[model samples]
Target: MENDRGTKRSRWRDDDEERQTAERRRQEKERKRKQKQERKEKKQQQLDQNKPDDNGTSEPKETSADVNGLDLDINGLLQFKAPEIRSCRGVNNYEMLNHIEEGSYGVVYRGKNIDTDEIVALKKLKADKNQYGFPITSLREINTLMALQHPNIVNMKEIVVGGSLDQIYIVMEFVEHDLKSLMTDMREPFLQSEIKTLLHQLLSATVLMHENHVIHRDLKSSNLLMNNRGQIKIADFGLARFFSEPSQAMTQLVVTLWYRAPELLLGAKYYSTEIDLWSVGCIFAELITNKPLFEGRSEIDQISKIFDLLGYPDEQNWPGFKSLPHGKTINKPKNYVKTQSLRTKFPMMTSAGIDLLSSLLQLDPKRRMSASEALKHPYFKEDPRLQPPEMFPTFPSKAGQERRRRASPSAPVARHGDHLNDNKNENDDDDDDGFIMAAPEDEKFGLFREQDKKGGGFQLRF
Candidate 1:
């Protein structure tokens, strides 16, 4: 009987302890729920206080009383405000003034901003011909221009669209004259000082491009624009692209035929910024002579012209020359002279200038001068200092009036399989030749007088 009473009392004590633990857990959960509700109410009250009234005005935020009524200064804290969101304006925002010129990627037009009354160059992207969603060349041009913001580079204001998805335009700052057209109209070649100034600007711009890991595949006289103040702006980045170390295999069909590098003609699959330097060298020679250094009719003729001027490449000059895809196909003339003719061609050039030019036009891509190195060349530091842009002579704006006939060949259009097909010859497709019809003899001016029969002066623009 005593053992039974003891067991029953122990059972009752255990039940009482279990009930006490359950009550404590319930109270704790209820307390947490009340705290959460209070926090939500406080947040709602703060948001309601800051909300705008019927008059579109909101109450000033109370920084001192914020954070549990602490006497803290919120001004010292880093506050992040949401960025303002905006929609891309339509092409109607700009009034088309006149058609400027058409390029491989787009058609250019002088436009005026309806609101600001500011003049801008509108480039209508060639999207209608593309079967794909959007043209990669247009995307690259837009992305490159947006990333590269230098004074020498043409400024991209904004991108505007038309009624359909196919109609897209890139808005840029209006530049008065292109170097090619200006040179074509000029009575005489540029002065030594003027050349130095122009080259300095070009090199400066090139340095910025290489530093940013960009290779402008095409850099020629027509692609360079100048304003009334004589400021030169590099334009037309349709062929430009970013590169990395170890190099990449890009299409050999890039760059205009006249300004193309020798390596490109010889089927060099892996090339870098050196190709651009080669174009710069050609531009340099053109600036001095007021004529193209090597004006060839075709790819073979172009290579022959390069060899005639620079001499045949050997192991001593260009190592691994035989390894190039098209190297074995090169046909050397029986009477080919083994001597370089740069010095003979440019007799008036200074020793320093000759050295700089030779370094830039080196047969080996490895030996070509870099933009930074070219900038520091003794040629620039020599006599005939660079002329200031302000001192440059202003010319009548032909681009501002009407569309003038382009003498130079257009840039090679990018094809669908261009990057994928390495074995295909660029010459196989006649459409990619970019040959322009010769202008009428009566329309010939300044530089065309002597070389009218040979061909008109080379000038390209965007």
Candidate 2:
């Protein structure tokens, strides 16, 4: 019995030794695995430090050029992957189509959505040179467009960035035709009813912009786009800015030359939304006459033209006009004080229309009409009544097709592919100074029925 018990004890001791050996071996293997993982993680962290951050920015690191044409250093070829020209389709589900046109700011292209198949206008902003980073103008446009949402305001679809740090693309709702394009295609000047429709839309859009504290520094006809549905939407916000207070100083070098306000021309350091109203007035005149109201050759010529028509500004008309930066330099006409008259320029315009125009074109910035006030102007309520947007005609789908059919071969025809040119000549763009006289006086009518001189005013209907 004693021998059997001793054997059992020896067997139990051997089993215990084997269990201890296995545990130590398991612990040794785990320690080795952890050490290997630590080394791998350290290497990964070093690599991540060299790569660009989430915002597409990276810390400046020392770079040394090697004979292989690769930057060799701690932040070397391994740091930044070569800029790959990848299709935006796999990246953001947008397939770029043909190039539309390039502007001073960016190149615009027609794009399609792979998911929805919706057409979009893709504007690729020009990247700034090294160290400057993303353009502030691009940032401003993106921030502004994202905040504004209205039927009349052009819609920004989404932003798509290329694999390369340099490429930035803004996706916007595609607009078929701009007013400039439409005007070129029209057989005759827009009719009075159509003018009312266009003005109403312009005023409505302006009201929305002003309400949002946004100032469209550039409000040219080319920036106003109209779809086939006759819905006009304001576009091109590269020059736009948000204003918090009226007293805030804004750059006078804003609007395009011809549409620039008198105060801006006089180098007023402080201005308000009145500057936009001035552009609106200019646009209104252009729409009615089918030509620029004041087509000046230069900045100096522009101010001179305004003075020639409206008479030289004085304290009597514009308080503190001479206090402006350029006011002192502008030479006044010798012994010539001209009386301002809209009648002479627009003889066929209705009285209400003239009144609204004068108010919008007021020499004093304070006297200029506000967008909301302009919408409520008696001119809009007067005859002929403002036409519905749906009634407005659409431009030809194929460029110059309608114009060619309407205009004789002898009549100057815009070239077949002229619209495709991205770099449009400024001189050619603004050449629509062809004055279109207002409709004949006999053809005009009032919106309301004329009251019998002796009879009670026309009864109101429910």
Candidate 3:
């Protein structure tokens, strides 16, 4: 009986050990999953914070890029095994050279096609699958670029997925410079003509996007591309999306705050292509004033600046002034002390400039000036109407010795299975005057809007 009892105790001890082992494993699994969720949340927050006003601070201003030839790759959270590109169905036979840029996403490398000796900018997603997570941004950028094409729009030659399910790369045209560089290079604020020229082409590009139902939710000077040839092309469509029906107003949180229009600022809903036009108008204002028109720190401050310049909004002026998400806040502009005035702020501007500014600054989106209509505005018909065609960008072949144009603007990206001779030109990629790295562009807007003191009115964004 003693021996049997001892054996039963030993069996119970073995059972307890097994139970402890299983519990340890379950706890470990739970910890790993929680860690992964935390990492994903952190990464998304990083992307959002990259935009200015996120976390209440601004990102470093962009700088000039070397833009030689190389491919940078980014990885996302998904467990993707990169395919072997050395074989079929890969972005092979391309040589990556120098580093062009490092943005919030990843590094961009300049590349040359081995088959035809053609040049391109290859973007590789950066991040580890296990650590930094996946490259949702690369996919978003590429997806938007694939279906879009226009004179004033940047073009994506191809998107390559390669390397054992781990390394993926996207190949695209390497633009020489963005408008931010142009703004930097010019000592003087862009001439009215230049603003007109840029706006006209931008309008053409936006019109194309609208036709295709793509909304470039993010439009800014930095997003505009310029080559030595004087041409400007719109780039960066990752933030853009299709304009679905009902036009449910997207997050007023898309474009850089300075370039954000009034309706978006007022938290207006039901946005459309009209929003893009508002941005265009703001860009025009910035180009001439060398400053933003309606700059505000917080949403309330931003709307206040607009009201001070454009005057207070009565339900009479903007039928539904009191119906928006935060309509009541704008009810009292004269009460706390309105800030400065846009006119006095930009003392150098002419009366005509003021007229144009007010027109674009209108509270109501419907009453806002349309691109086509603005193009014909008398304000632009001045001594030097928008930059003359001769002064703006021309075909790649005509871009001159500085910019190496291997083909005509109309040339095909591929010839007989070779992508080496894509007719493309690189903009000399630097600008000194775009936005002073000293302060953010939005801050500049606030300064200008607060320059002079105008009373009894306020600018309403919605």
Q: Largest lDDT belongs to which candidate?
A: 1
Q: Candidate 2, after superposition: displacement of residue 300 in Å? A: 0.4
For residues 150-240, write the lDDT of model 3, one tens digit per residue. 7678887766666755556677666777666555544345544556677678777877887778788788887887764666788766678
Winner by lDDT between candidate 3 and candidate 1: 1
User: How do all models score by TM-score?
Assistant: 0.74, 0.67, 0.59
The sequence of per-residue lDDT tens digits that candidate 2 reaches over residues 162-277 is 87867788889888877876666553456666677888888898998889888988898878888878688888888888888746877788889989999898898787788889
Off by over 4 Å in 3: 1-92, 125-140, 164-166, 335-356, 389-462
In order, the Cα lDDT scores of the candidates are 0.83, 0.76, 0.64
Residue 217, candidate 1: C-alpha displacement in angstroms: 0.8
Candidate 1 Cα deviation (angstroms), residue 389: 0.5
- Error (Å) of candidate 3 at residue 414 is 58
lDDT (Cα, tens digit) per residue for candidate 1, span 242-288: 99998978899999998899889999989999999999999999888
- After the best TM-score superposition of candidate 3, give how far the Cα of residue 455 lies from its true spot, in angstroms: 40
Model 1 CA lDDT for position 254: 95
* Model 3 global lDDT (CA atoms, 0 to 1): 0.64
